[model samples]
Target chain A: MLEIKEIWKTFNAGTVNEKQALRGVSLTLNEGDFCTVIGGNGAGKSTMLNAVAGTWAVDQGTISIGGTDVTHLPEHKRAAFIGRVFQDPMMGTAPTMQIIENLALAARRGQRRGLRWGLAKAEKDRYQELLSGLGLGLEDRLTSKVGLLSGGQRQALTLLMASLKKPKLLLLDEHTAALDPKTAAKVLELSDKIVAENHLTTMMVTHNMKDAIQHGNRLIMMYDGRIVIDVSGEEKKKLTVPQLLELFSKVSGSDEADDKLLLS
Target chain B: MTVFLNALPGAVSQGLVWGIMAIGVYLTYKILDIADLTVDGSFCTGGAVFVMLFAGGANVWTAMLAALLAGMLAGLVSGLLNAACGIPAILCGILTQLGLYSVNMAIMDFKASVAINVTQADTLEKLLVSLRFVQGSVKGDFPLWRHPILVVGLFTACLIGVLYAFFGTELGSALRATGSNGNMARAQGINTDFCKVLGLMLSNGLVALSGALLCQYNGANEINVGRGAIVIGLAAVIIGDVLFSKLFRNFALKLLAVVIGAIIYYIVLQAVLAMGLNPNYLKLLSALVVAVFLSLPYWKGRYFAKPVKRGGAANA
Candidate 1:
């Protein structure tokens, strides 16, 4: 479960190019909740996820993850409770390292790193089993450098790495945006399967309105640094893109959606 | 042929020292993905610190340790500049290097140059003189060589072995990952800033250790000893990468290749000099060599690989 209280974040505060990324935004997620977030460009969706991840200090806010106050924690310190898959596939994994090594790193997350030999037999077997679950045949290529993998495969590997330690919260920030349509569909399916099987509390941000409706138990829409709509349970399951669009237009008081978000 | 053989031992010995420095450079440049120029300053810092400590009655081991610590401090300064002040990594390195010049001078007892007089008291010199005396009494008129290159060569070999083992460890793997992708490392709960500082410190410490040994071997330490050292180290790394592409997967082999590359570089320089080349043009020659090696990767990637842009034709 996660709670964000009165979060406010401003970039380049008081400067000529100042932008208030998040303004008095607050949200909550119960245990095992999978929430899909939809927003236009600069809607603070990514900023909200980053705030949860502690990418930077919020100007004012209190964030609690599973009853632990983590708003003041540094990015690395908060990483034990937060697993993040970035928009860029390259941003989530080390390219030069082998697949098994990357998994080994993820498995040791939050533990004291030492000078011992990496990837003992048990760890390697555990990683192979986990990779096999992705159905990507990465289990057979434990020694293959991650750079040699396709974008989808790399993203899948990154997903596995992020979830290996079973963090308290998983953050997926447009994780499938960089992949081809088919690959994206496959990855999205895998994301659902993984989150469901692991009983993870996840926040997935996507520009696609259909995806927002099609997945997750809860759906939220944001505009101008605030959550405009939060739908869940029966209402979220029955929602359609048209209905969501109509709600966005009515709530934001704008018939015209941002071109980027609409086109995307 | 005999001249080449006679030069081989010295070349190999010096190459090992340069190899250590090159590997140090590779740590920051290739692994950490930062263009760290602190090596240039730390190398001289090492030499100055070593000589000063040794002259102040410290043993060789103690002097070497001092040099390593001094180099680490130099690297820490660079890391702090980049992290605390938001300066660019390269500029941070340059600032630290510039600051180290004065610090190194101060460390050398405010001297511009300090020459370790190896005429009599040096361990190697004493051993060599004793051997020569024995040879003189027995063989009479047989030439005797001073300063056994074998000891230095063995020491360097052991150092490389230790480094190879260390780099294969989990901590080393994490350090390497930090260089490959800092953000990913951080997302995985690795404190990348700490890793950067640790990597830079380790890198410059090794470089300074080499410089310390180099000064003792050469019998003198000048303020400018580290000038253009970064380029030389880069040249070694690039050349080593080119010649031993197959060995790149192994850290130790890559390091060994760097040692060979340095020796080959020196041999080429010596050969050019033997062919009546100007010794003063060493820097220019080094730059050209580095340029050629650096461009090889791009050249191969562009021309020799399958053409991605043009239909299915192989570009080469």
Candidate 2:
């Protein structure tokens, strides 16, 4: 479970370009809760995830994961309990490393790194099995450089790596946005499967209204750095894109829907 | 031809020393994606520390260890300046280099320079003399080519071997990942700041080790020995990577290529000198070599299209 209390974040504060990215945004997720966050541009969706991930210290408030106060922990320290995937496919994995090597790093997260031979035989076999489950043929290419992988394959591997140890919270920041629609669907399906199998407490942010509505058990709409609507269970299941857009228009007091968000 | 062949071993010996420095440069520039200028000063710092320690009656091995430690300290300072203080890596290197100017002077006992007396019965010469049979078989009154070239070459080979083994380890893989993608490495719980510090320490330590070896081999430690070292190291790494593209994918082979690259670079310079070229143009030659080799990958990617493709496009 994760708890965020009155988290506030601002960029370039006290400058001409000052922007209040997150304005007293507060939300909580219970264990095994799979939440999809829908927002238009600058809705603090990514900022909220980053604030939890400890990418930067929030201007105000506390973040707790599994009852541990991680508000003051730095990014690397918080990494022991939190796993994150970024918007860019390239941002989630080391391109130059072999697939198995990258998995070994993920597997060994928070362990003391030493001058030992990399990836034991049993570990390699385990990684192969995991990769095979992705159905991406990556099991056969364990030794190939990850840079050569397609965007979908890389994102899938990143998702697997992020959840390899089943951290307390999993943060997905528009992880499939850069992929083709077909690939995106596959990745989303894979994401659902992984989250279900692991029973992961997940927060996935997306701009696509349909995806936001269809995938997760709980769906939340964010506007101006605040959660405007939080719907779940059968309520979330029956929600439509048009109804969600109408809700957003009513709450945010904006008649104009972002074209990109609507089109996507 | 005989003279060149006679100098071959010496060139190789010097090349191995430079190779070590080139590998150090590679760690920062290639592996860590950081442009570090600390190498020039660190190389001299290593030499100066070794010479000063040796002058103070330390054993050769102890002196070398001291030099390595000193270099690690210098690297740590640079890393701290970069990671802790939020200074850019290049600026950190420059600051360290400037600070080393005084530190190096102090290491030389405030003397402008220090000359290790080869005539003195040093451990290296004593070890060589003790192997009379090996020396006598090759040339009477000779000591099995126990010059700096042989010692430095053998030492470099061992160093490269150890580095190769280290880079193949799990920790090394993590460090490499840190270089390739800092954010992802962090997300995996890798302490990238610590990795950066450790990497720079290893890099500058190797550079300094090369410097110490050069001092012992050349029988002198000059304040200016580290001058132009960064350029030379860059030249060797680029040349090596260009010549050994296939080999460089492996960490060990990449290290070896850097050593070979340094030797080849020197051999070409020697050849040009032999052709009556002015020695003053050596810096220009070094620059041109680096530039040409660095551009090679781009040129191949951009201009080396197949004739079939060209013809097919024309027909279309």
Candidate 3:
């Protein structure tokens, strides 16, 4: 359950480098909705996610999650209701910290940190169980610094951390874009399983059209600064690559989608 | 050899005193991932606050507490400048350190330096630890607990124990996370600004306490006492990290290593002085030693270590 209304953001206004990143964009996601967002280069897809995450305040418009307006809330304050995974795996976890410590931090999201011991014994057991569920053998090395983990491992760990506290809205900004196809697929599968199991409302951005189509219940295509195509239910399942491109051409009237949009 | 032997006790006691300050340095330099320059000013602020308070008839304990508070306030200013005003951490600390020079002078009643009336009945009897006690404990003029080494060693142990416990707490972990990865900390809903401020406060509090002890031991608080203090602090932290980082993985032991590093640093200084090195070159020597140690890891990794392919899912 998340809502965005009339969001507009322009970077470096009235200068040579000025670019309108987001222009009057609005979208709403119902509970348990898993939406895959697809767009070519500079489609404002990631910008939309960052806006919801409150990385920077939008020049105009409001965003609300679970019936609370977070338009003016700082990024960290907005973190109370949102879980985020960045494109860079390094961005989601402290590399020098232990795996269990990272999970422990996630577990206490939206809660005040007091003088209590950081990681409880019971939490360690629970974290091991969670790690085992990933089937990555991370349960055996809970104390190892996250810096030693491979990027894929870090990404998987970040995915687990994001949903550890069951955020009201999960935001994935090209979360698996950097991984190899096999690892990306595995991570995507894990994402689906985790989101489905938790009934999490999620918005995932991907450049690959197939992932945009093959995953999630709803699909939206962005061109320029606005969502131009919205498909879901039977229609979303029936959509294909050429058909989606045709719709993008019909709406945005730009053929810039040829190379950047992955047909496979 | 005789000169070295005669100075060993004083050197050891002075080392123990500075070890507490090194622990304070470690909090910012290692834990918070900040090379805070504010300690240079706050160190004297502690001595100035303590000496002025003690001279005005306050008990040593109360004066020490006041000094600790003064140091925390200095850290608070630096933290606000860095975190709130968006100044860089180094610049914020430098500004605070520069401003504190005048503040330290004012605290000494516009004098560049001040002394404890060690001859006065109140100042002498109310004192906690002093350099005189270093030889006094040997002659049984005072109890062993009054010895500078013993008193400061106990003080260092207590500081380390409290820091070890504090860092094990949830709030402390949050602060560590903030320094480790700000993005992750914020995503975890940690108020990173608050954590940075709290850490600076904690760090400067210890630094000031060390300064209070230093002034008491030396019998005077001078304006230049804290000059280049950051270099010494860095020397202790880097030395400990270089020598004991692998052997001392536990947090408490790492702190102990830092104190041990300070002792070793002072012993070397004393040895160099005894070996006919000009005393004025000590700061330069300290800076060079720290610089070399700081670059050792980087140079080893950059020039000697093998590069590996990064980012494979199979590696997971």
* Candidate 2 per-residue lDDT over residues B22-139, each given as its tens digit: 9899998888889888998999999999888777778887888898988999999999998899999999999999889899998898887897766655444532112222333356
- The superposed Cα distance between candidate 3 and the true structure at residue B164, in angstroms, equals 0.8
Clashing pairs in 2: none
Question: RMSD of candidate 1 to the true fold?
Answer: 3.5
Runs of candidate 3 with Cα error greater than 4 angstroms are: B120-122, B306-316
Residue pairs with backbone overlap in model 1: none
* TM-scores of chain A in all candidate models: 0.97, 0.97, 0.98
TM-score of chain B of 2: 0.88
lDDT of 1 at B80: 82
Q: What's the DockQ of model 2?
A: 0.62
- Tell me each candidate's TM-score: 0.93, 0.94, 0.97
- Rank ordering of all candidates by lDDT, starting from the highest: 3, 2, 1
- lDDT tens digits, residue span A1-264, model 1: 899999999999889989999988989999999999999999999999999998899999899999999989999989999988999989999998889889888888887788887567778788888899999888999999898888899889989988999989999999999998989999999999989989999999998888888999999988889999999999999998878888888898877664546875
lDDT of 2 by residue, A139-210 (tens): 999999999898989999999999998888999999989998989999999999999999999999998888
> In model 1 chain A, which range of ten residues has the least summed lDDT?
A255-264
The per-prediction i-RMS, to one decimal, reads: 3.0, 3.5, 1.0
Candidate 2 chain B weakest ten by summed lDDT = B126-135
Candidate DockQ scores, in order: 0.63, 0.62, 0.82
Docking class of 1: medium
Candidate 2, residue B255: the lDDT equals 79
Best candidate, TM-score? 3
Give lDDT tens digits, candidate 3, residues B1-316: 8999989989988888888888889999888899999999999999999999998888889999999999999999999999899999999999999999999999999998898877765566578888788888889877777888888888888888998998888998998999899989998899999999999999998899999999999999999899888888888888888789889989999999989888989999999999999999999999899889889889999899987878856454
